[model samples]
Target chain A: MKCGLVAADGAVLHRETRPTPRVVVDARGGGRAVLEALLETVVELGQKAAADGHRVRAVGVVVPGIINAESGIVSAENLAWAGTPVLAELKAAIGDQHVILAHDVRAGGYAELRQGALIGTTNSLFLPLGTGIAAAMVVDGSLVSGDGYAGELGHTRFVNGEAAELCACGQWGCLETVASAAALARRYGVRSGRVVDGAREVLELLAQGDPDAEAVWKEALAALVDALVMYTTLVAPTRIAIGGGLVGAGETLLAPLREGVAARLTFQRKPEIVAAVLGEEAGCLGAALMAWDSITDESGEQTV
Target chain B: MKCGLVAADGAVLHRETRPTPRVVVDARGGGRAVLEALLETVVELGQKAAADGHRVRAVGVVVPGIINAESGIVSAENLAWAGTPVLAELKAAIGDQHVILAHDVRAGGYAELRQGALIGTTNSLFLPLGTGIAAAMVVDGSLVSGDGYAGELGHTRFVNGEAAELCACGQWGCLETVASAAALARRYGVRSGRVVDGAREVLELLAQGDPDAEAVWKEALAALVDALVMYTTLVAPTRIAIGGGLVGAGETLLAPLREGVAARLTFQRKPEIVAAVLGEEAGCLGAALMAWDSITDESGEQTV
Candidate 1:
């Protein structure tokens, strides 16, 4: 995989491409083996980088689940690991170089705040509504990782009528179950028994004025708007950058979302809702920035 | 009214009591008259302090509705004023003294974070559920007033069945309309035609296991839990200090509220839910702290 290092000021200092070793998944070997495989990947990557005359100052690896950055541990339910010492493992693999580990969404938020739609804004929220929904916060010119567990916006319950869908996190009628890109396709598949390629087809059908598609799209938009309004009132960010697969619908998603949020606010400042800039590379870019920031000595005292 | 200056470290250095003058309210006098009366009260208080040999370095006056603390402007729908330059007026009255104006809820949050229940916690939220809902935030050991419009949590819409109650802010089914102290009494009064005193009576009835009171209390608790979950996910605070008239219910609100939040979380860390300290004095205390902080040449970073 190609590796690039970017600073918090959006400066790309280095770019290198190297073949990453294939990850081995062993269901029978259980959690310990999964940890071993991750350690192996880090060691392999380190050796390859060193062989190519690159000093691996810091390495950031993205994973699913609750991450406690302060303790350098990761708790990913899907990854079959609880309290994995990722930072320690990476440091051991790459010798004495600095290692920065963070949640993928937060890294993405850092990228957006520095070089994306949220550029120049001290207060902003980056929401990615893909297979799952989450948010990353940048406030007062710094990414907020409160106790290393912020930005879980997807799990917010949104109760509507007696009907409720169970979320992967075991909650009923969570915003993610109703508004994520997966949710859009899931709802359609459940109704028609036809598996669609992605949420884009449903968006296309809605654009063509299909009644079912329109209804589903409206429900998703309403759910997204409900979550955004709540967030806006709580944080009052200067802007909200929306990313992930659903955002590929472009103005179709943004226009209605802006109108919905505007109609709901009375005295609160309405944040500008726009598509994110970095797209798929957001997490990588943010990780690089986080690495650089961890190594640099800068005062973090600006107001948002 | 008596005045006491409470420092951010919970030190009450100055105390004085004065008779609060009654102000005439003329609904037909227009907004300018209300502004004039408010300014007159501020000027009188400032002059009295100055006469007493107090330096009167700064004044922090709080009001409801949307407030921009940086510019010291207030816009309240209930109050007659819109875009009232409160700090400028107060500055003019107390010549050469810096003036600080802020939303009442944000002030309460500052008080809680600095000298009350949330003391010693780095990340916490101060929610005052009164006539309307608002919040003050303390993140990473500092007060967060994003663009001076943060903490309007009450206006977040909650959809339940086919029924929607219009909020005073013109939004439908706002949490404030369902869960606030005023809402509890109003809902009970409308249903039984017997006016209850406040949320305290509702709590008393709920403790005795009155079916009607239980039903309404449960609904309010659920709504509150939903909002809390949303906040918890977004900011991942270490604690939440609940204040306002409704918090006077004490354990009746805290016990069930804690259980409700615990039941909803699958993987997220459950923050401590506690009642606010400083009681009714939180706003004034926070204002005094702000005044003292403004005069101090320190970095101005909050210590708690």
Candidate 2:
């Protein structure tokens, strides 16, 4: 878990990381342990902020799951949580400070939009090529939440026919099936008959011109390009920020995407493809930003 | 062209239709003639409203084109317009009245959201399968404009592999290439080796169980299913209203789409597919609604 204390001026006061407890789904109240851990972390972080002579005004928690806006419940597969009253529990844990819950990717995109790579873009996307892929879409100057169900671009189909693979999401040929960081590493191992150290070693082998690495990399790129083209054609974004682990490949990943999308488009608006600047800190920073925005909003003050 | 005079209370005062002037693209001033005709139509419509003892409060014009919000320039292929100062011309033609320009499909969607099939729904889609296909996306309680370049769902790839057809938009296997009304007629003719009158004739043939018509219809439905599934996966709309002339086929068109989309969806929110009401007049009504919204917005009054 990545946690941080951010000042009102968008400066990081303190940062820390802690190991997340593995969810034992089969045991009774297994999800409770995860929830308890989250509350403990938030309380400790608040205490640390006081020790550092800083007053915590609000707390923003971001999760990779579906958040029901009205019910304040969350359903996350990784967390082993189903319809958990996360918002109500958080409020009970920390009395009276404003608490904001948001999607991690959308919050990251908010950070990018406010102070990072997507600062000037209104219609844009923040697509992180992580272990599991998802998107944060900015349409007409506002982040689209779709009541916590929007921006599942990674789950959308990009691969078809016999070459397609089944995704962990129970769908076949999803963009995440071929283009996610985990997919790249897994596909590389299957194709080469040797396991490498994740997508990093796969990238390293690609730079050294290994045929299997090249093949898997090419497949990932093809699916990514198809996804990007489909997004551009449908939504007409002017900029797209690529983030997460695979973006560490830099020009190796971005150049082919730019070229492929350009070649496929006819009358559609072409988006500028660029790397995300904030890196892994984006989600943590975005949470702070959102929390600050909520307080500032209550005071009728504008947030940057 | 469908034009109408709508009272502030959402009653239709008058309505009329006129044939659009064909553009001679190779000839100089051909596009200018079309522009002049549009301007003339607006002036005459205002005059008609005046002669009927009702004042024209605003003029809302919707077009099938990319309208650059900053410059008020419009680029529509069918109209032979390239960066034409349409908003400026409309303003010049109608002296000082509020002249708001918008996309026709989006306007139609606004009408649907206000008074037709999509009322009481926030996140939804208004997709019309006309001669060509485009979508009017209602995301998070507002219609998405993307500065007039959004909602080209028809141009996105659906059919792939060797059977993919080249679309008029210069793409291969676009949803428009297989699912559009024009494509339905064209594909039926190609399969049967006999030209049908239109998509209506093809529908009639399908009713009689013609093999060629059935094949073409099946292809259209398959592509539509793919397109709807993709839309649902990404945008997460709760309802989808299908419009255009093909919708006259009613249950034949909607039943298979609903069943196919349901069968394919795994984790995505399944949208209720229903036929669009208001038929062809949707665009005109939406234009009026938008104009009223603009006016009501100025006075700090709620619209719908």
**Root-mean-square deviation of each candidate, in angstroms?**
4.4, 2.4
Query: How well is each residue in A1-304 modelled by candidate 2, as lDDT tens digits?
Result: 8998887778887888888888988875778888998899999998888877777888989888888766678988888898899999998999987889989999999999999999988899999999999999999999999999999999998887888899877889999989898999999999999998898999999999999999999999998999999999989899999999999999999999999999999999999999999999999899989889878544422121
Best by lDDT: 2
lDDT of 1 by residue, A1-304 (tens): 4355443454555555544333333453455565666667666656655665655556666655778777788887656667778777766766776677788888888878877889999888999989899889877677788877788889887645565799988888888988998899989777767788879888877888877788878888988888888888778888999999989999999999999999878767789999998888888777776776666553321100
Off by over 4 Å in 2: A297-304, B297-304
- Evaluate every candidate with DockQ and list the scores: 0.71, 0.88
lDDT, candidate 2, B148-206, per-residue tens:
89999999999988989999889999999999999999999888999988999999999
Local error of candidate 1 at residue B36 (angstroms): 4.7
lDDT tens digits, residues B81-184, model 1?
67878777877766776677777778878878777899898889998878778888887777887867777778787645455688887778888888998888
Deviation in Å, model 1, residue A275 alpha carbon: 0.8
Q: Give stretches of model 1 more than 4 Å off.
A: A5-56, A204-211, A297-304, B1-3, B6-10, B13-54, B159-161, B204-211, B297-304
The TM-scores of all predictions, comma-separated, are 0.89, 0.97
